[model samples]
Target: MKLRIAILGTRGIPNNYGGFEHISEYVSEGLVKKGHSVAVYNSHNHSYTASNWNGVDIVHCYDPEYLLGAAGQFAYDFNCIMDARKRKFDVVLIMGYTSSSIWGMLYPKNSAIITNMDGLEWKRSKYSKPVQRFLKYAEKLAVKYSGSYISDSRVIKTYLKDKYAIDSRYIPYGADLFTDFEREQFDQSALLKEDYFLLMARMEPENNIETILEGFSSSTSHKKFKVLGDTGNRFGKFITHKFKKDDRIQFKGPIFDNAAVRSLQNNSYLYFHGHSVGGTNPSLLEAMASEALIAAHDNPFNKSVLNADAFYFNNAAEVRHLVENVQRHDTEKTMVQNNLQKIQYQFNWEKVINEYEEFILECHKKNIHEKVIPGNR
Candidate 1:
């Protein structure tokens, strides 16, 4: 069935931002290709200047986020919801609750609100105690307001089902198999390819970036360790300062260009995924797609995706053990290849998008099927 979909949240398209933007780019474009109407909201400050991208309409909303700090996200979400209400979309898919839940009441009743409850946001170590408390409340509001929920991980699906007693649609993020990339794009230092290990993540405490770096530093391995993503935040600054003296660690700040990221992933001897909280990280899937030997953070979320086909590490010691004795682990290459096969079978972009489409259609159909019998006449 054809549907008019409005995707809210994120800085929007062609995905220079993060995973949410990446998901929006693929889903909006894919839905358009499937003969459905798709509109994605972009921040006025977004890099892509165009009003449309690959047949998907882009609506620019004024984002004063830089000046106002966190308050600006609320403003952006309210503006998007206001615009969306006017459009009268069949399905309005909200990527993450965050600020959106604050403006949930403004979302049009005509639209079927489907929210992606991103990880356990309040549980992140990044947020202040009060902010975390607010997020916990926001989670409740989001669950109450949305017609349905979309979980990016099975672990999350089970969380929502068990906590709120609602069956959230399970549709994880997808990544393109990096069979081709600009091989020369990587910095000369990180150009060692299979000799160096890679750790690409937002330098946050909850992500265990420091833990991974600590382990890598402690190891006697002669290979260089390549680190990506920006160190602009306070946490980032602290991390950089802590690891600055290490000549073996190359801090390639925020390589947003997809080709460069793919090149780094494809060439890296090992990919270190330290995200301990997030649900089914896109980078992890992309690493699997790139056929990198993965050393993922040991957690229920990561375990659900990587299963027994990964070198799981719970702390600095475990990571160090893995690094120091990687050669002793003869099954590392076999596990890496198995992860690649998992991407082919389970995490294919086409399959992910098709599932998303089906879920969107299902939400729309349920909303339409709601019957109101005449009462108290």
Candidate 2:
């Protein structure tokens, strides 16, 4: 059935931001190809100013985030939700509950609201205690207001079922296999294949970027440790100052070139995934798809996706040991191959899009049935 779907949350598509925006970009385009009319809500200042992208409608809402900082997100979300009210969408898929869930009461009453519960926002160390408490309440509000839910990781799905007693659909984020890039395409001529360590993530406390960098600094290996992501933020400044003495530790800032990044990941000696708070991270999946030997943070989210296919670490000391000791042995090859297999068979973008289409259609069907039968809701 043809459905009108409005995707809320995120700064909108073509993915200048993180995982949510990345998924939104692909899923929005994919749904359009499948004949669904899709609209994505974008912030006013988002670089992509076009009214439409890849056959999907782009609704630019007035966003004061650049001027207002974090508080601007709430206002932007309010605008998105309010605009969604007039679209008459069949399914309103909210990507995260961090700011949008508070306005849940105002969500269009006619739409079958489905929220993708992204990570445990309340547990992020970046937020103050009061903000964290509000996030906890926001989670509940999302659960209360949405007719259906999506858990992007199996671990997150379990948490939703155990905590809220709601059986959320387990739909993990996906990545495309990296095969088109040539080794020589790497922008940095100084870096050689498998000669440097790579860590790409936001400079957030919970991501344990400091812990990974600390381990690299302490390690005996002389290979360059390339840290990617915007380092202009407060924590980024502190981390840069603390590690300024180490010549091998290079902060390359944000690299948006997809081919360049994939080449780096594909050629890296080891990719350090330190995301401790999120569900199946897009970067982690990309690293796997690129066949990088992974050393992920010891958390249920990372562990579930990697299993015995990658090395695990918790502290600076462990990271140091791994940095110094881990060699590209046959076993390491097996681990890399295992991760690639996971990407091809399970976490591929095609499969993810198909699953989302099926899930959304099913929910729309149930919603129609509920409306037809009074009190069934």
Candidate 3:
């Protein structure tokens, strides 16, 4: 069941960005390995300029997001859709509908459109009421226009079913179980010997970045608290301005090197995941793969993955309590082992790719079959 698939709605491959880019990179390469012809759309400003990556074709499309601000993404999607119209792919996989979902109707005919309805973007606190309304409408359009849907978390799958009655395929992101790190590399990082805590997230209001920082500030521990993200937004500015005097907190700008980030995660005494808006976050999965003692925000999405392997935090008070009383749990060894096993067995890359491959083939066949049958739509 080989497929000709096109993945859209991401910045590009090489995974320098967030979850959508990572999914495009892995899915494209993985499907190609399974004898499918996969093409991933890349923004004109993407770092990778090659025509091909890991045996998957790369299609560069015009993107204006760098200059036009948020509006540029819709323009970029329009260009990609126009280009895809000519190619006539068997299946088109759209990673997210942040902007493109509104134009779902513009998507070319003769292709099965399968969209990954990302976490509830409309519910984020960052968006204004009007913007959130638009996002909700976009979600409806995306679900209505797409032939099928994919959800990266079961919590999300349930949301789609309950909210829109759409039966989306459940497919979470996968992580590599990383055990290879150089002692020299870890030593050179100048980090405390598995004593300090670490957090890696986009400096956004909805991600509860300030809550994490405030919690660390409230703690009496002497160990350093390191945060890895660029404070380039207004929300980030507020957090830094408020926490500037905290001597124990350290803000390291964004680190793109996966190996360096992995080393940091693997050696941390505890990794704090504050993102409450996304399902099965890539950073959380990386933390799990690194087998770090996890402290994630207490949300159904986070709980669905971490389960008992993590110590949950709802507010700064809970985070403070978890931080100050970390030793009493005595579950690091058991928790680490449990998380590692989950990554190896459930979130493994092999299983993820197989699921994606099988779903794409199913969509492809059903699409072809629907063309011959009347009233199937």
Model 3: residue 6 alpha-carbon error in angstroms: 0.4
Model 1 TM-score?
A: 0.95
Q: Positional deviation of 237 in candidate 2, in angstroms?
A: 0.6
Give one clash count per candidate, in the order shown.
0, 0, 0
Q: How far is candidate 2 from the true structure (C-alpha RMSD, Å)?
A: 1.2
Per-residue lDDT tens digits of candidate 2, residues 258-335?
Answer: 878888898899999999997999999999998899999999999999999999999999999999999999999999
Selected candidate, larger lDDT, 2 vs 3: 2
TM-scores of the candidates are 0.95, 0.98, 0.97
CA error at residue 197 for candidate 3, angstroms? 1.0
**For each candidate, what is the lDDT?**
0.88, 0.93, 0.88
Q: Mind giving the per-residue lDDT tens digits that candidate 1 earns over 211-317?
A: 99999999899999989989998999998899899899888899877777887887787789999886989999998987788889889999999999878898999
lDDT of 1: 0.88
- State each model's C-alpha RMSD to the native: 2.3, 1.2, 1.5
- The lDDT of model 2 is 0.93
Superposed Cα deviation of residue 345, candidate 2 (Å): 0.6
